[model samples]
Target: MNGPTILLVDEPTSALDHERGAAIIELITALTHERATATILVTHDRTHLTAADQIVEIHDGRLHLPAPAC
Candidate 1:
């Protein structure tokens, strides 16, 4: 759980109910901070976006990022 760890969790909350989902997310976030591990979470849920340090959205095999204003 520590020392150069990488956690690749896919749809971790997909099967959980709302309360459980939130709790799981909180636990994972806390573990990331406590263990200082690199966590890569993959999901289609936008609600978890705010918890991420960086957001990379992929659509139609392409990645999207915020574009500069004209």
Candidate 2:
């Protein structure tokens, strides 16, 4: 691919508590943006998506892309 480097993270905070989980996602999102890395974070917790540029979700076996800009 000729796009920016993309990192795919699946459920990076499924096991941790709410606080720690938010921290982890925040860190990943911050680093990704600071380095211009295109990150694809697959998460179920919508609250932890503060750092994402756009949020995409899979619903009914399809991709939903109504996420707001960051």
Candidate 3:
């Protein structure tokens, strides 16, 4: 009733500077939890993994299922 509950973000900060990029990630994670929505963020930036409930990595052209957080 509020809005779309699922968010898919692919390289949402690809064109931004590091500071702005981090801010964007922070906003995204906050909104995801605040709205109780599912967010699928596909990015090469592994630093944002802490915000994810599950993480899948692509290795050798295959998707490796969610691995234990490092």
Candidate 4:
């Protein structure tokens, strides 16, 4: 509650190996939930998409947002 409300991470794990990348993702996820902070993760890595609650895809210079989860 004392930290910034929004967290922006760009290519945080780009230079990391699979295991290390996953660890970074896990740490971010934990912080996001624990702090109740909104997180925007910008990356081209599809492997980490599973950690997302919503997925946004940018293709052809357009943004595609997923349907609301029900």
Whole-model Cα lDDT per candidate?
A: 0.83, 0.82, 0.85, 0.94
Best by lDDT: 4
Model 2 residue 26 lDDT score: 78
Instruction: Candidate 2: list runs displaced more than 4 Å.
Output: 1-4, 67-70
Q: Candidate 4 lDDT, tens digit per residue, 35-65?
A: 9999999998899999998889999999998
When summed lDDT is taken over every stretch of 10 residues in candidate 2, the lowest stretch is 1-10
Question: Candidate 1 has what TM-score?
Answer: 0.80
Q: In model 1, which runs have C-alpha deviations exceeding 4 angstroms?
A: 1-4, 67-70
Deviation in Å, model 1, residue 39 alpha carbon = 0.9
| Candidate with the larger lDDT of 3 and 4 | 4
Error of 4 at 48 (Å): 0.7
Every model: Cα RMSD to truth: 2.6, 4.1, 2.6, 2.1
Per-residue lDDT of 1-70 in model 1, one digit per residue for the tens?
A: 3366888889999988878988888888888888888899989877767778767778999989867559
Backbone clash pairs for candidate 4 read none
The lDDT, on a scale of 0 to 1, for candidate 4 is 0.94
Best by TM-score: 4
- Any runs in candidate 3 off by more than 4 Å, and if so which? 68-70
Candidate 2 residue-wise lDDT, 1-70, digit = tens: 5456888899999999999998898799787877787888888877777777777778999988895559
